[model samples]
Target: MSHSVEVYAPQNWTVEQWNFVVWSEGAPSNTFGRSYATADWLLTQTAVRPLVGIVCGSGLGGLADLLKDQVAFNYRDIPNFPQSTVHGHAGRLVFGTLKGRPCVCMQGRFHLYEGYPIQKITLPMRIFKLMGVETVILTNAAGGLNQDYKVGDIMIIKDHLNMPGFAGNNPLAGPNDERFGVRFPCMSDAYDRELQQLAVDVGTELGYRDFLREGVYCVLGGPSFETIAECRMLHKLGADAVGMSTVHEVIVARHCGMRVFALSLITNQAVMDYDSEEKANHEEVLQTGKQRAEQLERLVSTMVTRIEYNNNYS
Candidate 1:
């Protein structure tokens, strides 16, 4: 269905109408200026000049607790920030130090299924860019598509298949902002190879090699678990894990010239067989994330200490 022409005019809409567009569909007004304004607001609340940014996914909010001397803001307190309604999400932006390296963390993340437009959901990435973050580490709880992967495994994202991007719901779909990046940004190296290697090294040192795997993550618009056929197809199409968030934020972060590294905690195994009695649910996802939260934190925080020295974008 197509929207009426009047919907394009954000200025004339009521606060409720404008919000519905941004929070539900999308806004033509999600421009560079708006991102800059929000970044300016956040800059004042924290004394730290964070060079690293981390996004905590699902039940992984414990990662934020690792930060020392934190200054946090509720999403509702920030201009242009969307509130997170997901149960596992804490809906806060925190600025603090991680092992003495200045960093910022998102205790929660926005999602396509959370009534947010693609751009609105990825707004934090742009805010991260404007706040002077050079490297971004993202973690998510996902369903495992690779049969070799078990529940509680950690899959380092070497690449991803943006299922929503294929349908033209990409966060960077609208007007181009040259200040942030080129109109046609190359996604071929979206996940920084060096960072991927570093994560492996860290995980190995921490004796997490057994549960650590690497593969492409496929992101679908969710809130609904995939059918058996869909899971089979996605796995055959090269997805090791499947999820709803992270990919858009990765795209936005990369577009803004940040070095990116991401990983997924395989919360549940995707049921690819019709006869299987197993099921996928948020409770399972959150529970798995809770179980693996500590090791995930150790892996990321260890990488953060070495990121500045090893992070070469070239």
Candidate 2:
């Protein structure tokens, strides 16, 4: 006997119907179940049990190459994983050791502008927690919003303004899962303080004080760069960096009780003056990443070692 299975064709669905079927279901329990399934499959593929999870931002995917004894899986090969749509994103998960600490790195990350449901974008955070990862290091390429910031600088994320969340577009918008976190999670301490300080100390030790900074990052829904007016308003609102990713991932990681540390590589200066000839472009972002990639790698690797030492001693 033979059995046939039917799959729903999204192409035939109306726009409203599609939205309802995807986002309206919220963070379904099955999402958690599928994450476990994915995690199990990963375990079978590699002997590495990671304690740290890193998500590469924009052009920062080179960080993953520093890992030793690596095992990698393409997004297309991973069950239920979303493929990256942006250039400069390699769309792979790499498992290995960085400075003797077991880590899993997402060579690429998903974004809201990619048309993925918010829950889907953050699913990896929960999977990281389940895989026994206690710390998450997030990196991104951002436009400098502070007047004092210049292109090719690195900013440790101190806080964030979720511009999209203010309008009800939040990763945690779905029904709360007690298995993952409380119904109301605090954002007050979203970015780990000690890690921020550790990054500062690491950068200083690496002689990166001249360009190292710490400040608030504001997230805007983008595939589009901010307009001059928007850039000016963000600067006045106290943001030092602006980008399309990271904020949502941090929220999800914190919700699941993982320690979070994030940094932004200032790829370009946001145009706050209409008369200015400056424009924000992805090509410039990629170029800046290449320019500062080595230093950023050194700083993060040093921090990872320090974190491992601290965990062992304290």
Candidate 3:
């Protein structure tokens, strides 16, 4: 049975006749039913049983190579899945072992700015839930909004400011599917506290002291970078990091009762007041991500190792 959700479009959206598209067929069994089914089907063909799911951020697909014996599946092969179209996104899922733990990772991700609905953007995490992913590590490339943060630093997501989804446009806006979660899921400490500590511990152990930071992440709808005014406003709003992804995935993962930990790679500084001739762009973001890719890889590998060890020994 397909679930129909009631969506409220913003007043500005009415001029464009932006209405919620009702899906009537092949609806997810639960909120995460379809993707879970697809992922489970894929996992059955492989020997690995994933303990966690990881999503690679823009220009960060290369991180999947760190996994051993990867079984890759294109997004097109999955039923009810959205294809990734961004330049940095690879549109494939890699199932393998990362740091000796069974893991499945997305080499790319769909964005709301890519014309995909919020539900489609978060569908993969639902699949992760079905695949028995008890925890999720979401990584994204973002422009730095905090004054103290520098490019190439990794920021652990402690909380989020979901300005887009809460404004009547949400992946969970439609009908409440009780199988996935309750109608009103609480957002307090949505990012698991213990998991956050584990990430921090790993970062500290690896001697990435100054390069690692933790703060609130703010998500925005964007194919374009934010303006100076917007960046300053976000900073004033208590956001330590700003990005275009992660928030939706975090919400879906949390709704499915999975533990979530998100990290943001600071690609560029949103320096609106700078008088120098520097600016933030996609090329710059990708280059910075590439330069810091090894750091991110090590950080993630260490964190995963810790999670598996603690979960197994405890």
lDDT digits (tens) for residues 1-314 of candidate 3? 01111111123433122212223354433444455445546766777778788899988887788999988888888666789888888898898998689898899998899999898889887777666677899999988888889998999999999989768777778787765677777778688888888878888888888899899999999878887788889999999888889999888888877888888999998866857566779888889889989988898888887774224210
Q: Estimate each model's TM-score.
A: 0.90, 0.90, 0.87
What's the C-alpha lDDT at position 150 in model 1?
Answer: 92
> What's the count of clashing pairs in each model shown?
0, 0, 4
User: Which 10-residue window in model 3 sums to the lowest lDDT?
Assistant: 1-10
Model 2 stretches with alpha carbons more than 4 Å out: 1-28, 308-314
Q: Model 2's lDDT to the true fold?
A: 0.86
lDDT of each: 0.87, 0.86, 0.79
The top-ranked prediction according to lDDT is 1
Query: Could you tell me the TM-score of candidate 3?
Result: 0.87
- What would the per-residue lDDT of candidate 1 be over residues 1-314, giving only the tens digit for each residue? 01211222335546565445445533554455567667767886777878899999999999999999999999999998899999999998999999999899999999999888888899888878778788999999999999899999999999999999888999888788776888888999999998899999999999999999999999999989899999989998999999999999999998888899999999999998878999899999899998999999999999999876434352
Which digits, one per residue and each the tens of the lDDT, describe model 2 over residues 221-268?
998999998988998898999999999999999988888999999999
Q: How many backbone collisions does model 2 have?
A: 0
